[model samples]
Target: MARLTILLVVLVAAMATAFAPVPLSRTVSTTALNGQTRVEVKIGEGEPIESALRRFKREVNKSGHLMDLRHKRYFENSQDRKKRKIVQARIRKRLERMNARRMRQRRS
Candidate 1:
């Protein structure tokens, strides 16, 4: 009878845990200061601290946190923004041409 009670308790606990709603992903908390953004990662059970930190950094990078901070660091007038955009487009075109040339040379 005592063994039966213990077994029942164990099964109940297991069912409770199994039916609990699981979070899809760990929460990412961000803080910004002095034009830089910092990310805090909560390490999960059995997760290495270094691996968690690395993953957090990767997530931040993929989300453009650093790029956003960089763009926000200085005020840009409309003219300046336009000029920068033009320069970037030119540079992009130049790079594409160079890459195409390299590819053609490689094919020869």
Candidate 2:
């Protein structure tokens, strides 16, 4: 009698699950970039809708799509770009030297 009851319960549970509708959201895709595998994820079932967009944005950032868009947003001559980069590099080096000096002083 206990066995029969357990079997009936399992059968009913299976039927309920089979008939229950499952909501699925699509936000998973695989892409190949320069022979490298890239997996992107988005929001899915039981996840907030806003999180899906955030995931997409993060994926774009990982793929450097956001950087590309920003670069293409303005028209700049190659020479100007090079000059800008040189100035930025100079500033970065100066900052690095200053940081190193500060660190050495602290250690001493």
**Top of the candidates by TM-score:** 1
Q: Write one digit per residue (lDDT tens) for candidate 2, span 1-108.
A: 999999999889888855666545654555878966566675566888788877776676778655656776899899988997899899999999999999999999
TM-score of each: 0.44, 0.40
Q: lDDT of all predictions, in order shown?
A: 0.80, 0.77
lDDT of 2 at 34: 95
lDDT of 1 at 16: 89
Residue 34 in model 1: lDDT: 98
Residue by residue across 5-87, what tens digits does model 1's lDDT show?
99999889888855666553465667778966677677778777788888798878876777766776999889988998899
Give the number of the best model, judged by lDDT.
1
lDDT of 2 at 52: 82
Q: Candidate 1: worst 10 consecutive residues by lDDT?
A: 17-26
> Model 2 reaches what TM-score against the true structure?
0.40
The backbone clash count of each candidate, in order, is 0, 0
